[model samples]
Target: MEDKNIFDMLENTDDELMEDFTGLCPEIDDEKFEKLFAKSEEDYKTRKAEIKRAEERYNTEGDNSVRGVERIRRPEWLRPVMMAASFVLIAGVVIGSTAMLRKDKWMTGAGTSVPEAETEDTTEEISETTEEPETAAATEEEKTVIDGSEVENITISTRWRDTVDEKIRAADDLVTMQQGFISMDYNDFIEFAADPSLDWNGPLPSDMRESEKDKIYYIRVKDEAAESIADLRTKMKDSYTDNYLDNLKDFYNNNRYYTDWAGSGFDDLNEGDMTDKTYIFLEYRGKLYVNSYVKSCAVSSGLGDSPLIIANETDTSFTAFLPHVTPNVFDYNDVSSDEPMVEIDDMYCEEVKFVLDPECNDWRIDSRIPHDSGVFGELYNRAAEE
Candidate 1:
């Protein structure tokens, strides 16, 4: 038989091959056996042609066809299996080729990749080659650390002590005493006593001795538009005295204010002398002294009884004044010890005038002397002598 005829007969045959000849005829009982066989032969020829074309492309473009060469070698009987396998194999080859082409994008190497070769040629054309390592020198500035704590000391100016003394004296002179009228112009006092130079750093003298205490009482002027300073003082005094009397009644009832002294002599004295009295004092001995004159003045002025009294006792050499005589209590603790003691610098109209003893250490003026004063008169006098 002719070679072409023999090949055609072999391609058309459906007879099952023995296990030994499995390589020659792969499909044992396939329904499309003839078609599969024909397709296999045609695929092999197409692959062979592809290999030749790829080899030519490789030579011309400096690419490779080793993968395409590998796909064509798989057997004819195993064509279905080989075709599926070839798809995976071809994909792997394409991926590998792409990676090789992009190798310089990801890796630094001794051998030139396509992109690197092109970059080298472009640089050569530009005539701007990078300098060699031995010839190159760094031009960066060195970092520095600075010490900023060595600046010069600044000088501050201060006022003389005599200037402050004069201001206090001027405030004292503003007091006026008349029949049924005891008043002080606070505005005039503040104006004269305003000393810009006074150094406010020393401790103030606490509740003063009776003799040194300012006898002139100050009344805060409440009217915002009152033109005369004297009118302001009168209004402040009237308001203060009215509130004082009301608080006194509350105190005598063994109420909130005087309740602190309940079991003491203050309790019994409140029952007798407090009746029909505008001002009552709890003396050092704890006896209540009722003032009838102040009561009459309070009634005529339409002001309530004075809740507190200011008394100068000869034995103690101290002036006693009750706080909260007005509706609001003037808190001595709120006042700074560093500030001038007698000067009413706070504009809040909250301070009640008190005469503080230099030797007194009372935390509250009514109580025993404050603990900070060293043994009261004893240590203080000795220190003064020294």
Candidate 2:
């Protein structure tokens, strides 16, 4: 039994791994397993291509740290193993990011104004302001952090694989859940976002995930009892994954954008939002819990979403101020992000929009509108007295 023989057996298109793997993974239906495998393989190939392109660009372009990690390409015999590894990674990203999320695309925007929530303690919020000293320079850092005492607990959901597997075993209960999400109003969507118990849908096809979130992803349709931006922010914090701040910082500082503010006005800049932003930030709150990972410097590009722009028709958009991230500041001479902390212009937070859809339909994002805008568009100077 040569090693290649085993690989060849695995690759025997018609009679190969499927029967054995399915025999092993009997939990999933053959159709579903095949679909998932095919989808995962496509994604794997795409990622591999992306990695290759990045490596090529790295060699051809200026050297940078963003391209530091390289996926070890195993011998062809290990293709199946490699595929499984990629699936696990992507699954983690999908499930862990969105508690009950639509897709991995997330947006955080902030500039000035926009704050309200029925759950919000306006009196308390106002009272909290007195503790801070306001300055002319403070105009850009307009966020107020919830005291640790005030925070209940960050709701991190169960692992994606287990949660998904459980859903599959539950006689496709997830499908019903998915259909029910479509009819949610802005407030309902917020509730869904804030809830840590829900997983967007089980064994959901990535295509379904992508299409559903955008199309059915409507928000702010009704003003009555609408969720305030403050309420949204507080709720969103419920399940933020580790290192979210760093991922956000990387997206803000490094994503390719027109940045009319910068002299680097979209010269060879990657267009779209989600890919440019390093962390798609599965909306556990906005939609799912938080999992933050460093973007591919966003220089190499993948996913992005600018929270600066808002949708008011089927949704509402708001800007965010990251008063807690850093002091409001910028260097006119160094708009180009040659260094991490150096290029950071302001203490920014993410902005979000709530989408409304028919509760009976499967949940979806509104793809017609921009899902990508160099991920998390800059808020400009938002810091100020709140």
Candidate 3:
């Protein structure tokens, strides 16, 4: 028989031969089998053509590697045998894929076959074993009883109340001091004609006339207030980090009309009520003018009862909530009036937070969440609008 007749012979196999092959394969309709066989034969032909080309090329350009060894060409029968094997493999794959697709079962590539029944049983067993313990543990935990000693371990210590009070006092003191500057005003245009320290040769502005040498008036911070300023320094050093202290110093030195106050000798500058000598005002062109110094008549606010509530706490750090209320402006110059100049109903109605972090030996105010500017902000804003 011709070499090309091999495929035809397989297709027209006798009833006995087909019966033997049928036992090993899944049953398929004749039409589907014929179509699959035709595709396999076409692929085999294309592969055979490629092999023939490669053999012809090898023959034309003899290989140098086989110089000493005998060159062995492929046998003629081997081609048909390989083609038949390829056809059988293709048909087997198609049949196997179809069967697997119909059943719709998963397979692993590792080639370790597990029985379907055994795999299902193992999966169910694993799920059951994992779920049962978790349910039992949850039920037992729900039934657990915590006694007094255990409760005490979880509760905040009573000593923390004192700490909270101390924090509130410190915060109150600092905020009050900051608001003290709101009522203070300094007139930069005031020319000190009487002062020997100022050597003035420049012409005065059209709107300003220099004060008579003897007509200068003095306005000063009170003695008690000066002592409080000294005390503020001590409190700040104790309650703030060096970085925060520097920031506070810079703010006071530049903005609060207290240029020399950042230095260690600030207490010496204000000793024995010397605030009068430091602050001098003059009537310039009929306008009341104060020199470099500021005169404070403050608008202040204080925290409510139970000022601080512990928001969160740990060994090294804690956060507290501050409720501010009853904001009022107190003008010392307004002695004729009994009541405050302005009593803001809800100046600091919003809650603010203060954080304490561990300093060298004690906890110090680290930072405030939204910097609480206090009653000064309200007064300043009102003054600006007016």
Candidate 4:
């Protein structure tokens, strides 16, 4: 073929012309070219088959089936032909600079050329990025060390989690607990129990007000109740992903307690710390622990009807929006009860994405996007705009 025809064919992107480039390839001995071309074609077919199998495994078995595969070593002669074609394409690009500039950008951090001696290293580098399946997983399984013992990587079973409905239910379970519902405890789910005693104290308000008299008081959680509280904290850490857990801890660390100047607040004032800042003393078994904030005996009244709606679902992840009405919070001194605290209404609730954890085969909260309503949300949105 003529040089001009080669450039014209490449520029036009004629599919048939592009496919059989062996016609334009440099002349070589007939027998040597046939042998090399046949070998390379076989290698290409094998690589394609391996990649297809890997994708199938990934869909059925999750990420574990995506283990690295040993890339087939490309024949040496094939590289020269590819390089020649690349040069031809570059020449065409020079002739069609306007189209090239419009459609393509230079590769970032790409070096000019590789020495012939370093060709093998360059081939290996390219293979590493290739998605073609390798045979590594058959010989040895990936391992992780837990508690000083090596364990082979295993995927979570799809027995109980085969359906989309099941995944949605699991997401609801996590979101329900994350919203601080008092109905269920973490001990009911996770194996680990709460710490027996923790001498942690919350900061106190700058000054105690008369209105906080009945509102701010410490409740002594002893025996089973104290253990339950500790277990809840432990389970919360396990349930949430790193970001949400950090936010929860930051809220706890920033919270300040309020105490009355007249001393005794709750029923057993002596049992609770009466320092400048109030502290709730929890007695787990026989030991005592202090906490900054604890949920009081208040009913968790809400809009009642709310369901977790999942969106953008895939084999590995999904976005869930739990729409529920926010409960109206009454002040410490608000004695007049009028329309009631909760009403059956709809609002943007917790927005979170649940991702399938390939390691354990269970669903975990990947991320939480805060979607609040009422006064707090308005203030937050306004501030964000500013």
Candidate 5:
């Protein structure tokens, strides 16, 4: 055969180049190359026959045919793998040396890298304050807090509370005699409710003058209240997330109480301990326990439509005075719990108090207790005619 350029031969169509291809692969040696081809042919025939036999067996025996021949079942990847191995074997022999296909850039003149110096621009270290950066990564938006900014108050001490204890006990005893509304004796409740202190102050207020805004005193906050509300909200969220209690979750979800008080004006101040200036203009609900400031007694709750009242004391704290009641029960010289009592339209009415906290920025409900006997009856009766 006449010598031919290998590059020209490679440029020809594969079919033409492959025709008598063994004639070009002399490095593989004729004997070894022929042996490989024969082996490949034998493998192809064996695989084809096995598949034919399996198909016939399946036709005859259905699903059970697979059990008849495990050895003859060809692995799926075997053909591709064998083809690849045969290709590599032929290429290795034809190429004469593996280095023709091997990459040894580290050991070769062809693999040398350009030896340029790494130049850094030393003009200045651009300060963030002076220059813009190439990439401005987007920051995650901050989540808006669910807050109403409320400060709760709970009255823990008052001189009149002690003076009212005997009335509460006597009223409770009288109610126990009455049918249906029998509260456990004040004695029985002594385990939970401690008796008021003996440090006697003045009597509970009496007369209609206390309820009238013209006669009573009040204080207002223009800016500190808003700041206190913000503090309260942050604290509440921190507390809620820390505990993650379900009831706290409910409290966290409800924004009504704070919303209700947002525009509500100054609170009435009565005669009491007015020692601390910070305690003035403290913040929520009626002086009594078990009340909702957001909704009327009977509006959302299927109960009495009792209106709210606020009674403040000059010495320290306040109470809610019934608007309709002419006499202030607290003012009377010898006021019984029953004298202040009034039956409301509903049986389930309650009262809540937001007494001044030590910080005096917000009011909080540390805890609440329902008025007993005469007091309870008065609150009930005092619910508005609605």
Candidate 6:
């Protein structure tokens, strides 16, 4: 019986041996087959243990099959769902990674995509808004008339009227003589003319030798005053007279002789044509004289009294008075026929000096002498002789 079973087991194929052993063998009966096929508790435990052992062996040797043959079994019904879930999870992970890469690319390109042209325009606009406005230079459009000529070509000196105007404008103030008058003393005028700082082009009234040239200075002042004589008188009344007198005295005492009485009167004169008051006049001898001659008011009312002095040169006293002559009171052409005068022997004097007697009340001698002396020694001598 042992020999027959051995021969039969040896002769049977794999499937056939499994089938015959299951069907006919009494020792390996239906109960045993059922236990193997239907998973009894012990069978189940054994199967689990075998699966565990197989997994351990597979982990260790990289093989999980009987006799090195692969086992084939039908998958469970839920296997497809699990596979689909796994596929979905893998696809989600790949999609999320791709989205992150795209975001990084966008962030990296931000700086390179900015428009340089817009930035430049913005900078230029800001710069232009912060810049200063351009100022127009002085030109012919700003030229003023003087001596019948449009004074376009101006050479500024410290004594020049235009230069004084410029300086006063720069300082935001009005241009009054340091002595507060239209003119200064002969020496003061000379010093002022000689100073490179003073803007001067021609000779001053006191320096003019030719009567015609001398008349220009007077005419200039008269014209200037005519334009704004009312305003000038107002200014004189307000503060110019006091300021001018003090400044004139100081300038005269410091730079020139104290005998320069003409400087004192120059700033004190009022040039109007409607009042019969004392008039301050400039002498050709560069001396200041107060004329008692009456004249019309050339300016407006309420424009306080002109700065006229009532004292002669010998008195050394000063008394304030009102307008006594017109704006152009002493016409340059007027000269007396019989007038006593003195001749100066000193060439260094540049002009002659006339000392009238204390009783002589003629102020024209003073006016004519200083006025002509400024221009020519001959005219100065003639006036001095008169």
Off by over 4 Å in 3: 1-161, 171-235, 249-307, 326-360, 369-386
What TM-score, computed on C-alpha atoms, does each candidate reach?
A: 0.13, 0.16, 0.27, 0.31, 0.16, 0.14
Error of 5 at 116 (Å): 99
RMSD of each: 55.7, 28.2, 48.5, 36.3, 48.0, 63.7
lDDT of 4 by residue, 76-174 (tens): 999999889767765554555433333322332235464565556544544453221232332333433222433232222232233333443333332
What TM value does model 2 have?
A: 0.16
TM-score of 5: 0.16
Weakest 10 consecutive residues of candidate 4 by summed lDDT: 328-337
Q: Model 1, range 280-373, lDDT digits (tens) per residue?
A: 2212132222121121111111111111212222333222222111121222212222222121112111112223333432111222111111
Q: Which rank order by TM-score, best down to worst?
A: 4, 3, 5, 2, 6, 1
- Highest TM-score against the true fold, candidate: 4
Candidate 1 vs. truth: CA RMSD? 55.7
lDDT of 1 at 219: 29
Write the residue-wise lDDT of candidate 6 on 1-386 in tens digits.
Answer: 98898877655354435666677656767877887777677777886786566435433332221123223444697789977975776566556545654554475563455467755654454334312111112233344332243322222112222322232222111221222244332222110111223222222223122332211122123323323434444443332333343453443333221222122223333332112111123342333232111011121121011111121223321211112111111211111101112111111111111123244331111111122222222222222223
lDDT, residue 161, candidate 5: 44
Candidate lDDT values, in order: 0.28, 0.28, 0.39, 0.38, 0.29, 0.29
Ten consecutive residues with minimal summed lDDT in candidate 5? 288-297
Error of 5 at 329 (Å): 24
lDDT of 3 by residue, 43-148 (tens): 9998778656644443332222113223346799999997897677656655654555334334433345768896686556544543445545645542312221
Name the runs in model 5 displaced over 4 angstroms: 1-305, 320-351, 358-360, 371-374, 379-386
Clashing pairs in 4: 69-133, 69-134, 70-134, 156-361, 194-230, 194-231
Clashes of each: 14, 64, 0, 6, 46, 41
Residue 132, candidate 1: C-alpha displacement in angstroms: 99
